[model samples]
Target: MKKLLLIGFMLFQYMSFAQEHAWVYLTDKENVATSIANPISILTQNAIERKATHSIPIDERDVPVNENYISQLKVQTGITVMAKSKWFNAVYVIGLETDNISVLADLDFVASIDFADKSLNSESRVALSNNKFEIEESLIDFEYGSALNQVEMIGVDHLHVSDYTGEGIVIAVLDAGFPNVNTMDAFQRLRDNDDLLGGYDFVDRNDDVFEFTGNEHGTRVLSDMAGFIQDEFVGTAPDASYYLFRTEDSAGEMPVEESYWVEAAERADSLGVHIINSSLGYRVFENENYSYTPSDMDGNTAFITKGANIANEKGILVVNSAGNSGGNEWQIVGAPADASGVFSIGAVDFEGNYAPFSSQGNASQPTQKPDVVARGAAAAVVNSSNVIINNSGTSFSSPIMAGAIASLWQALPDATNEEIKQFVRMSASQFNTPDFFLGFGIPNFELALEIGLSLAEEEFVRFKVFPNPVSNILNIQIPTSAEPTNLKIYNVLGKLVLEKNIIQSETKLDLSLMASGVYMMSFESNKGSKTFKLIKS
Candidate 1:
């Protein structure tokens, strides 16, 4: 009986050590001498340039975690460091026994330790399979034959024709795995031009992303943005530089992937990636206890969602896929998709109809989700074998939209990321009346360009009209280079009250004869036309 009791105790101790995946939160970066005021010491030159261009200030969160703390923890026996997050000031470690946790917590620099997984060996939660629709491949032509339809559907072809094919933009794609991206002919131009900057596989904690034997979901998703095959196909942003990050583990669904995603995002930000395209969403997990119900779809509830928001705050545009759970019993968009400031994309057919499998937004959230829809249903993509094929999912749509956004930014380099998002939303077909399924509807890149150009003109011209409530004369001041070619004043009833042709920098309008109310003064020039509200007394 005594021998049996000792054996049972030993087995219990072993079991306790077996389930030891926890996060060690460091108290501070004390050992590191780098100060947050000097971001150049931590961030790359490109990252500094990006922040300067966007007027984003460097904060303490941008600094790397204390290397001394990490090294000390690594030296401890029976502990294996998994991943590190500078944003959270924490490191995920496994194999930490109860005694080690107590001792580590007692360290001066150790703030806290939380078990990532409280229970193990729970019932396996079923993974949600992607609802992909297979379609026959179309005949490839010499001029974006199959790919043209997708780009033209969202009016991105206009930007491409205008020489804004996302040149000088850097985008980071985070997904399951990119199997044959290194050898795929469709990505040859990206490789040849050195646009494929770098990549890392967070799951294995290595940089060998191309050598993975996981799903080809990332390959197909990337083809929507970077793939090019002469005239046969042209991606949305073929000239944009890319960073590929493998953050998803195809074999399992767990919260640890979220931590991996945060780590990859921090890396992307450090590398100065302008945009991040994430085709993965989380709601269900391998452990049922870790699975999130629809109520947790609130943007702030999930760990990944919080990280995505922080990435946006760092001046990086995040585009995510609205999960394809429309027909499932738990039908709703997943966590990161509901994240605020994220450009969530939904799936739609070529006919501009919502795809049945496209997840809907949570009704409880005030903000309409799925900022826009794109040609995700039967979307064209290049597989790992370098063959063009058709598949269906929002995974294809998010990148499609992200590439277009990159092109838009390329065209309007002076525009802020927030302004670009606003323009895209305003240019959508249903901006005034958005719904949960396809919020604001499909975006028209052509319209967005017009708006951007108009805004630019306003900034450049700096034209102003003053003397609102003027009893006699109203003065108009125009920039010397942009003298008004014509001017017109209209009443609220759309009746033209006055018209004149001006070739001078200053024009005086006699408003004494006009009745007191709201009127509009129109100014037309070679650059563009603008209208301003005039208040008369």
Candidate 2:
């Protein structure tokens, strides 16, 4: 009788203290049309210009979250607002696992509830953790020194030689604490140039990002892109401007960090950031019940992944690190990396070999992940102490690749974000044959530049190909020309599969007889020869 009484008492106590983490989705915004009418009020002038250049519409997603709804939730008992996202029109809230919080669902403006702990609600959980960024461990006119291998591996050196070093480009680095970036000698150049545009600590809700006492993961990640130390070192995009944002809480592994990331990304978009490099990934968490399975790696799932796609749609190039779980149980790329719009990056050694620790992509997913590879094994980086060190993980590779992309974008300023991604993918070494490990393999920036320049020409711009990665029929919209054009399709092994003569502006090729694989379609004429990557589904 005493044992039963003790058990009943313990159950009551457990229920009293249990806290829940969830996202409280709002029904509608109070003023979407008003905000869209005056975009400059919410977004920076530079951001407005970027959207104009890309022809992206300023829709309701660009509107800020309604403050009144947040105010109402803030006044409620047993509820604490954590973060809010303008893209999803939702607010992250933490509260006691009791009737008070659950009553939020009954509110008229509340759309629904998504609990981080699946047991609290009917929905399954997504991934959240910082274990991936833990690593064992640049520049221009520039001795790359220890950073030479990584920069040259992706042909960033060639872009630097052409004087395309990310000048006028803005990048936002989102990760954990950036302890000494404000004082690091390696970043002194960035500070002196005044390229260090301010940032915010979303985790602590402060303006300071370099004052934390946790891990220096952000410092290391930033060094790969913005660090400069004269002849001793030069980051890939030393000339590029930066905004340092701390979104990860290294002290604890919680699902709220994902909401923190979305908030940061929304801020980045408003600031007109041209590129966003996230050297962090999510998978397992402290509470196994909040973990996501391998199948959940689909791009359409995960709150952060959805936010990433929205970031891409807003014309910001989102670059993320493929997690370091290749040899572990969670071997697939995690969360935002699985996001189709995200350019997920993987790790390679100095010799251009795949790093065993680099995360692989899901075979079932149609979109190839880890879009490309770079030197991550023994990659050179600057730490919080302002010292160069060797580290291994996709964490390092992502920044290396992102910095190169910034430089590439600088060279091709007029190119759209989608065009830039296609240029990089087409220039990859394994564009004709990608796998789960390296995706399209290491890219060649020099080759990508060449392709971009060629395609940018007025005559070449008229050449359009529809439905890339087709199943049965491929359509080509040939540019009008007096000279007769010839077409050739080749397999991965460089063996010719089909040849045809073009007689009109539009032509269709029946590929149903061909086996499923990647192909290179070449259009040759008196003007020149242009090749495009083709995939068979």
Candidate 3:
């Protein structure tokens, strides 16, 4: 009996150390029905699971399986596998027979299945509590040519939609109470775009996804990123969709908050969400020893950090705030952003300068975080009165950037999340050189759109290439329908060195004599001048 208890304890410990949350991809390549039953229990030895897209959905509630119901499901749809405990209905069951996807899709009772992990891989950073402030003037809009911040907003009216927006993409934004979101006029565009989807509240552990309460900060963040665009402040992804999840309870910070985020992410994954955005992070608490040191930032110390990484592996894009209090003294950007796989966004002023309050990143930790910067400095967001208020924080910057990224994603649906991240990073204000303050700097969606690499369905200039990677000869393939065209080629440097004009069929350029380096070949046509990255080797 003692030996039995010891064995049970050992098994328990091992299970405890396993990944906090996980999901399996349901694919067409594998069958899910074969299971071996021992005298004690059903054992899964080897029947071929784990292939990409070879995943199955189970009830997250973990209610006792109705043998009758299971038999009926097998008869109705061909799903023969029973779910395992632990994850309940929250996780995708890996071995469901591949035949039920169509039938399951037809069932309105079934909500959604796992998409991909968009969680950030970074670990949580140590917290620095200083210089935190509230929104100013609630929410407001400046004149078309106002003395206010025009540097960042310059020419925003003509800014084209050409990047990923989570349009039709459902994201579960787990944070504190998003107070007064419905009352804000700035979020009206989200309503108009139908980007605002339904959500659940795990903070109160119920379903008041948009509760009206203290610290309207959370609501402002959501509005800046996913709120509909109006005459007030325009979010990055005005047309992208969202699922506002409330995981952070009001008033105080609790360790249980971490567990709540995990559950929320798991639910988000099950709901076929494309991304999960959490602006709330943890490091310190009223209980001082609960405070974390830099070493704990490996992503292993916190439950939420593990969930953050798991969400990424599943293919959902997770974006986190780098945190405030840069002016005082913080070690690096806080966790899950500090964890390895996530994108941490810092704040920069409208003048293209790093905000003094924005956090910094150390070269160490799970990863060098605060991967990029956005106009987090004194930016405009919608307030409770449906007014536009100017707010500032890495928080505000993150959502604004997220909105733009969502639009970019919308524009380029085919872009891998990592590719989208890289594209944004490469096209940032400071891609060539980065610093602790701004990282890769703010991204230029105009540039991203001009490249026309995104999956955007909108009409934009598309790059046409003929005989790509031409050795001695480069051809500018032209369509007869296109207007007259002008072409230019440049090395990595912005300096222009080659120019051409297309009169008829196609224009040819000689590159065999050119030095070896990545170059950009661009064409100015009727739609617009589009650019593409050229590889020489």
Per-model lDDT: 0.80, 0.85, 0.57
- lDDT score, residue 302, model 1? 71
Q: What's every prediction's RMSD, in angstroms?
A: 9.4, 6.7, 13.6
Better-scoring candidate (TM-score), 1 or 3? 1
Write model 2 residue lDDT over 1-537, tens digit each, in one string. Answer: 999999998886565337777889999987778888989988999999999999889998888888999999998888989999999999998787546578999889899988777767776755544364657743212234878888988999999999999999999999998988999899999999999999999999999898955788899999999988877777899999999898998877777888999999999999999999999877766666667778878887678988999999999999999989887777889888998889999999999999999999877654788788999888888888877878888998999999999999999999877668878877889976888899899999999998878766544465777677798888888777456789878664334678899978888888889998767677889888897667788
How many backbone collisions does model 1 have?
Answer: 1
Q: Clash number for every model?
A: 1, 5, 70
Predicted structure with the largest TM-score when compared to the true one: 2
Q: How many steric clashes does model 2 contain?
A: 5
TM-score of each: 0.79, 0.86, 0.61
lDDT of 2 at 419: 69
Residue-by-residue lDDT tens digits, candidate 1, 1-537: 999999998896667435466678898775244555667788888989898988888887887888889999998877878788888898887664645654678778999876644333233233444332212245332334778778998899999989999999999999988988999899999999999998999998788888755588888889999999987878899999999999988866657788899999999999999999999898866434456667778888777888898998888999999888887876788878888768889989989899988889876753578778898887888888888878888888899999999999999888767667767876788865778788888999998888677655533346777666577888877777345567877553334678888877887877787888656566778877775556688
